[model samples]
Each structure stands twice: as structure tokens, then as C-alpha cells.
Target: MDRTELFLAIIAYTLIVQTFGGKAEGAMLPLFVLLFALPIYVVVHLYRNPSLE
Candidate 1:
């Protein structure tokens, strides 16, 4: 997929996960890592410089 399709796919995925993820205990790990921990880590890690991008 190209960038636009890939971006929309990710947005759809995140919307589903955020909307229904908390209804089940089994979803907690992925929900936490993907929605919380990973974004925070990425922002902090790239705050200085994201040259790798």
C-alpha cells in the first residue's frame, strides 16, 4: 500500500482498538503498549532529533 492508504489503515485500526479495546482483559497489554507506552517512548526518543526518519 502507498502512504495514504497505509495511513488511513492505521487510523482505522487505532479507532477500533481505542473504541473497543477496554471491553476485554486480554486486550490490555496491546492497548497499553500501543496507545500509551510506545507513543510516549517515541515522542521522548525523538524529541531531540529524529534524523533516522
Candidate 2:
């Protein structure tokens, strides 16, 4: 339920959906958004809260 765990869960879910759903083409946009957004969120969060890092 912590941030790291939540992040990992999101990654795992995305991979599972992409792999098992057999619709990579359709899922690409969402997958890409998740992949890109997560890192950006982390970076902005860290930048805003240096104490967290």
C-alpha cells in the first residue's frame, strides 16, 4: 500500500494486461502514458520534496 508497492503493482498490472489481453496495439497508448507519466510524477514529487529522497 506504500508508494513503492503501489508503483510496482501498477507496473505489474500494466504488463499483465498488455501480455495476456492480446491487444498490445489497443493498449499501447495507455501503456505508454503509464510508463511516461509515472517517472515524471516521481521526478516532480522528488523535486518538490527533496527530503523524501
Candidate 3:
């Protein structure tokens, strides 16, 4: 498995989940946008690029 990606996914998932956990109480939208965008970009990249290896 991709360790770095796994680590980041877990971290991002935790952050996103936590932020939305309590009705998004005190959630930072700018930061959330950034974090939320990253995974989407990565997913798009992977799908578009295919397994180059």
C-alpha cells in the first residue's frame, strides 16, 4: 500500500470527520476547503493518470 497516501488519508479523514462531527462546530471553512479539495484532486489525478508503473 502507499504508506504516505494512507497516512495522509487517515489524517485528513480524521480532521474532516471531527470538524463535521459536532454539527461542524467551530469548523474552519477555508482550511476545510483546502483539506477537502486535496483528496478530490488526488482521486482525479489517479483516475486520469492510470497505473503508470
Candidate 4:
């Protein structure tokens, strides 16, 4: 999938299931925030390090 689609799917899946495939459910909020922030963080990191591409 494209980057945006992949990111959205990750967020949707994370929000949809607190446990995520019955593996665990100890830290929902932190997992959600990390899931949601990952894309933004990637963009910001890319902006800061354009030459890495």
C-alpha cells in the first residue's frame, strides 16, 4: 500500500482493537499515541534530513 494508506490502516487497526490480535492489552493509550504519531514523526524526520533520501 501507499504510505498514507498504510499509515491510516495502522491507525484504524490500532484504534479498532485495544489488544491487537489478542497478543496483549496492557498499554492501549501509549500504543495508540505511538501509532498515531509515527507518520507525523516520519514526515518531520524526513523534512529534517532531506539528504537521507
Choose 2 or 3, whichever is better by lDDT.
2
Query: Each candidate: what lDDT?
Result: 0.63, 0.76, 0.69, 0.69
Candidate 2 matches the true fold with a TM-score of 0.52
Writing each residue's lDDT as its tens digit, candidate 3 over 1-53 gives 58567656666766796766986544456456656987998899899998865
Off by over 4 Å in 1: 23-53
In model 4, the runs with Cα more than 4 Å from the true position are: 1-26
Model 4 Cα shift for residue 16 (angstroms): 18
- Please provide, for model 1 over 1-53, each residue's C-alpha lDDT reduced to its tens digit, 9 standing for 90 to 100: 97457545655666677677776454345545555755776788798787767
> Model 2: per-residue lDDT, tens digit, 1-53?
89678767767777777889976666566557777988999889889898863
* Alpha carbon deviation, residue 22, candidate 4 (Å): 12
Per lDDT, the best of the predicted structures is 2
| Span of ten consecutive residues with least summed lDDT in model 4 | 18-27
Pairs of residues at least 3 apart in sequence or in different chains that clash in candidate 4 = none
For model 4, how many clashes?
Answer: 0
What are the models' TM-scores?
Answer: 0.41, 0.52, 0.42, 0.44
